[model samples]
Target: MSSSFERYQKRRLISSYFSVVLSIALVLFLLGLLGLLVLNAKKVSDHFKEQVVLTIYLKDTAKEVEVKQMEKSLAMADYVKSIEYVSKEQAAESMKAENGEDFMEFLGFNPLLNSIDVHIKADYVTEEQLKLIADETTSKSFVDEVRYDNDLVTLMNNNVKKISFWILVISGLFTVIAVLLINSSIRLSVYSKRFTIKTMQMVGATKKFIRRPFVWKSVRLGIIGAVVALIGMAVVLYYIDKTFPELEFLKNQILIASLFLGVFAMGIVITWISTFIATQRFLNLKTDQLYY
Candidate 1:
């Protein structure tokens, strides 16, 4: 009967340990998912920002050499990602294709002006920077007028600001939640061994020596949990990459590596701290408190 009871206790303890590890893995996996979102937030914002193109129309008097010079200068600017020169004929043809009619033929001459479509870099898409770019481009002697959807730029900027703010808030909240959840899981695991801790102390064991095994054990479990979380993230990324490659989340190899390292480190650090604190609590408790 005694042997059977000991075996049953061992099985229960192992089951409890597994439960703690599994709970920690789920929490860490959620945090890892958030890390991906936070890292990719800027990339997503930049994608939308790059979509706002500025069209700089040139006057009829603008020479081919002058157009080439302007293109070369714009290409060197930090704000410009790319620029495409559209001849009046090309513009007319595109419009005709869209409308399924030749408006230029009806007008008897090409009324379309030659234009340079400027795709500005994401960093320079702010309203102030765009206004400055328009002012500068419009001041050029060969330029006729600058055109873009002003309302779209303003709306996109506002939406980006709001989204960035919310992500920051959500990230902070998740961090706190991750800490609390891991700490709680560690505490429950240590609580089951409260009597063992007291017995060791009563037998002249030093606090450091008694805490060592528990800390190491917990840290090892933490690493296991982190591995599980990373695997889950890998599966999620694979599915997302297959369906939504345009998000480009997988393209940022450096950021993904850093995020994985961070998640692993977070698991180790939080587990070590929580286990140490949890063990210390039991070590300092009164023998009678063990019953409570």
Candidate 2:
């Protein structure tokens, strides 16, 4: 009968520890998912920013050789992501297709100018930088005008700023929630062993001696829980990669690795701190007060 009771208590203790680790894993996994999105926010923003094109129209007197050289030079520019030259004929045809209007029949001549569309890099998409680019391009002798939708650029940058602000707010709130959840779970796990802690102190065990084993146990559980969370995060990333290949999220391996290491260290640190505090509480309580 005594052996049976001992086995049951042993099983219960093991189950309690398992529950603590599982809770930590779930919380950390959620935190990690949020981190993944935060890390990829810049990439997503850049994709949209690079979509805005700056069109530079050439003077009608410009020679074909000069235009080709200009296109090559623009293509090699650090700020240019891509460049495409549209001849006067191609521009007219595109307009005709869009509105079903023949420029030659309506106006006797095609007034559309030959232009080069330049997609600038993400970092140069700001209003000030764009103005500089347009002014420089227009100052060229062979360039007639440089044009882009300034209003649209302004709208995009403003929207990106708002979105980033909201994301940061959400990430901060979620982090605090994650910490509270992990701390609560660790405290509960320690509460179950409160009597054991008091008994050790009653037996003249020093605080350090009493804490060493439990602290080590907390560290081990923290590591195991973090590993489980990382595995969950890996599965999620794999699914995201397969489902949304265009996002190219996995390309930034360094950031993802840093997130993984950060989560692991956070788990251990939080667990260790929570366990220490919880154990310290029981150690300080008088024996008679423990019943309350």
Candidate 3:
């Protein structure tokens, strides 16, 4: 009977340990996911921002040399990421390919004006920056007009801001939830050992002495759980990189290392603090109250 009772206690201990580690690991995984989202949000925003194209239409009288010079000058602009000059002939060819109709041949002359397509940098996609670009381009002698989709630019900027706000709110909420969950799990695991804590107290053991072993145990669990969570996060990131190769640009080695360190620190700190607080509560409880 004694041997059976010992086996029962051993099984209970193992179960508690497993429960605590699993709970902590799950929480850490969620936190890591939130971190990755926050890290990549800006890169995604920039990609969309840079897609806004500004079309600069050149005058019919503008010579090729003048247009080329303007293109060279615009290439040096701080706001411009890239510029592609579309000659009237190239524009006519593109339109012909689009509809299988040779409008230039029917008209006897290409009516399409030469134009430069400017891809602005993400930092210069704002309304004011674009207005300045338009005004400057329009002032040039060879430029007939500057055109872009104002509605699309406005929509993209607004959507980016909204997405960033929601991401922040979600990340904050998950962090709080993770802390509460990990704390509760550690508390329940410690509750199972309440009798041991009380027995040690009755034997005149110091609180520090009683807590030392449990603290070390919690620390070990924290490290193990963190390692597991980090592995899970790495696997997820690997899958994401494979599916969306463009997202790889956002994944810097230093940034990922920092994220891993953050998870490790969170695991260790949350587990240790939760275990300490839970142990204190049980240590203060009287033998009669232990039942409750």
Winning candidate number (lDDT): 1
Q: Rate the local accuracy (lDDT) of all candidates.
A: 0.92, 0.91, 0.90
- lDDT tens readout by residue for model 1, 52-165: 999999999999999999999999999999999999999998999999999866779999899999999999998889999999999989999999888998999899899999
Q: Is 2 or 3 the stronger prediction by TM-score?
A: 3
Q: Report how far residue 97 has shifted in candidate 1, in Å.
A: 5.5
TM-score list, all predictions:
0.82, 0.81, 0.88
Sorted by TM-score (best first), the order is 3, 1, 2
lDDT of 3 by residue, 90-141 (tens): 9988999999999877789888898999999999999889999999889989
Backbone clashes for every candidate come to 0, 0, 0
The stretch of ten residues in a row with the least summed lDDT in candidate 2 is: 185-194
- The deviation in Å at residue 176 for candidate 3 is 1.4
- Candidate 1 yields a Cα-based lDDT of 0.92
